[model samples]
Target: MQVLLRGDWRQRLRLISGLILFAFATTHFLNHALALFDLQAMYEVQQWRWIVTRSWPGTIILAAALVTHIVLALDKLSDRATLRLPAWEFIQLALGLAIPFLLLPHIVNTRFARDIFGVNDTYLYELARLWPDSAVLQSTLLLLVWIHGCMGIHFWLRLYAPYRKFQPLLLLIAIAIPIAALGGFMVGGRAVAQMIADPKTFDEVKQLSHWPSPDNADRLAAMRLIVRLVFAAMLTAALGLLVWPAIQRRYWPHFIINYVGAGSANCTFGPTLLEISRMNGIPHASVCGGRARCSTCRVRVEEGIDAVPPATFPEAVTLASIGAPQNVRLACQVRPRGPMTVTRLLRPSTASPADVDEAERGSEGIEKPLAAFVLDLRDFTRLSQKKMPHDIVFMLNEVFAAAGSAIAVHDGWIDKFIGDGLLAVFGEKHGIEIGCRQALRAARDIDLALDHINAKMEAEFGRPLRVGIGIEAGPLLMGRIGYGPNVDMTVIGSAVNVASRLEAVAKEKGAQVVISHEVARLAGWTPAPELLSKVDIRGVSEPLEIVAIPRGRDLPASLLASIEDVDERVVGRAAF
Candidate 1:
């Protein structure tokens, strides 16, 4: 119970209550849709619906959910450090806030009058009062409520991959339900209007409706006004809560923040660096908002690191996972305590929610063992000098496309394309052992793809294209780097550097692929002694042991076959 009062519990409560309210609204819309068959069909469905909805249990649950949802929304609004939000979020918020205001009169007339004034408030009574007169207002309310519910559902469900698969069908259903209900409502209203035009039918419906006397109707009107006034006061109080802090904090102690390269801004102590950036129009990358999930908003504290408090629990976990230096901090988590000088690690650009992947969420800010695959096209400068610029671009595109396809097939992420070279990372999801084998397989696939491409391109170009492939595995920090459209999720470590060096070595030795001894050991492969060699690598103190494959296709099949054998052995032991 105490846990429910703190941290993310409020968000959970809001979602659950909103879902209950949405369910109620859906059933109501479905009941309205039955009016297409005729007023009798609508009447029959409403009777059954009222049996459940008008019961004490249903009424209490619905009333509780509605009150809770609204209160939570207002509380969230009051906690906002800045009104700066993504466009979709802003639209959803606006629509949500508008719903209660538009819905109040209808609720007061129907439910309040039915309960307190002994009015029947049946379909006939509602249609006679609403048709053609309140039609537009009612339709507006229906659309707003439906749209707001769908947006909330979409934002929440999109976090799960399964929901994304059925989003198109779900969206179609969302659209069709409201439209059909609206059509039925209009059709039913017209039918009621025709009936009311006849004096005989009008007399029957009026008696059956059990409408209140004129004096009672006047009393109901005054009650509705009172209810509206009370609601207005509550709304005003919520807005005051939102605004009072901003006004009071204007006089709070301010701190100056100096961002290297970018300009500086002065702000009060409460808002985070990322919020301060947005408030001041400074470009900052925060792909996951300020949730401390994505580390895109990390900055190196160049000065005043000592004055700033250490990272909180969540921030510490994210920073440690990403192998962030002691001086580095997430801009979203760090509140400026005093004057500080910091450098933004990621450039600012427009980043959408799509930029974050749910499956890869856990790996975002982490150090893990990953295999690096670096491939460089050989003699590309000479080829470019011989060919026209367009021809060069076309040729490079084909090569890159083939290489990218091959890497993807083996579960590798193409980190970046460097002129004529490329870098890929493996083992983010799987362990390093499987990742090493996958890298070797990807290197072989790339070789085969290039062979096929050369067969067709040899007629246009003078000769076949050649590439040097290198594979290495070690603990590496993987993260999203750069800013704007140029951003890439890449790996950075000495292992990547060594992989590039091995690619150069492959070119120097005139071999197709060069892999470190570590790769062979991890992948469960034992190369012939004669095939192994020790070579000095640049920026390294000791000579490295490696294997140079003359042809990628020549890699022993046993390297992959061993994995099945190991799995079988484990299963066998478990069975005993």
Candidate 2:
């Protein structure tokens, strides 16, 4: 009983309800587009109205489904509010809530009036009466409906692979359809007004066309046939798309059971887990409609771990980064080939412990000496602009991989990648001296990696890649900020700013690697007599002692000469 309400059931309910609402909106909009065919398509409109609004069972179901959907949405929104979502998310929710409020009058006037009061007005009569006095209200309602529906569809497609592929095209069509429909309404309304004002000239001008009349028997029959065929085709396609995946599982047989515990149930497996949980009733969290993207439906495999297949790449990456235990897995991502006992790890009020720990750590901190390394790839923007997007991505992957490998090999934590630059922190978990040594080793390794990359690029693209690196050791404060899921783990202090300035100086001096005297002292490395120089860095009250590092034994003798010229130029600039 706990298993059913725990995760999968909630997600499935949200997905089914969302899709039903989407289908309802689509059909309703398409029906409005009928105005494009004729100014007085009252017969077709009336037929739709009778079938959907007049039938007792259909009306009841529509009301019930809408009420349920709204209630569920409000519940979800309240949960998100507790998490303190961004301003944009809140704005979107506000707009979505406004939709039903704006729509209530139209629904009550048209459907409720006809069903409860037996005021079976023609489509033209209803449109004419509603358009003049309620134009502003009607326009506002239409805009709200279209925006809310599109936002829902956008979020839904983002979770599904098939829909994701056609997102751009779907967005274009979604935007254009509403424009075309609104334009047709305006044109059709004007045409109808002209016909009513001068009925003598317009021979076909008629009042209150009724559906299922003897005069329109053939048209009504054709309309019913088309509607039925369309509904059948949609139903068939939807079923095939959804059900076929499960049926194919018979041969491929990918079944996974996850256990989520609220203290009492002994971990169990199989279809019975879902069935029993639903029968007994238990509360679970599955906010993303059971899609694998939302990891809310996660469980910890407590026993029979070998029964589950290995985690997929995305699942593994997400889990490992968040430092989840080996047994922890998203229920939607895992599929069991055999029986497995699982325990639910999360509750409505709590997230993963590791995530909570990181969030807490990010907020509390103090200034301490840390080693910083910065690397900037020269002329990368121009290089990227010349290459195709796919090729550019390949190049960037290679570059980042090489740089990251160097940093990791020297025991540094990659702080962040800034476009074509790399920033890393050394000895984050160790003392300042060790951190300085690690940063220096990382710089040497990066030079070696760059040489290899340049050689390969020269051989392949007939061009070399150049980069500048800088290392510094100083005191800095590191912490985390931001709200909810969007928190940033960040470092702050004069040390960071100084490290960046040194990197900029490396570029100006045309040197491969530069180190501040502070870093050299911290690492217990004596500055080479010929390589030492003093320069006034921007924003610093005192001039800093700097050293330029040469690449390997193959260093050009003229490198020292170039450094001398740069030093003289800096002095000249300072004098001026």
Best candidate according to TM-score: 1
- Which structure among the candidates has the greatest lDDT? 1
Task: Give residue 20's lDDT in candidate 2 (0 to 100).
Answer: 65
lDDT, candidate 1, residue 383? 83
- Note the clash tally of each candidate: 0, 11
Per-prediction TM-score to the true structure, in the order listed = 0.75, 0.41
Question: Can you write out model 1's per-residue Cα lDDT over 56-75, one digit (the tens) per residue?
Answer: 99889888888899889888
Q: Provide the global lDDT of candidate 1 against the true structure.
A: 0.81
lDDT of each: 0.81, 0.60
TM for candidate 1 is 0.75
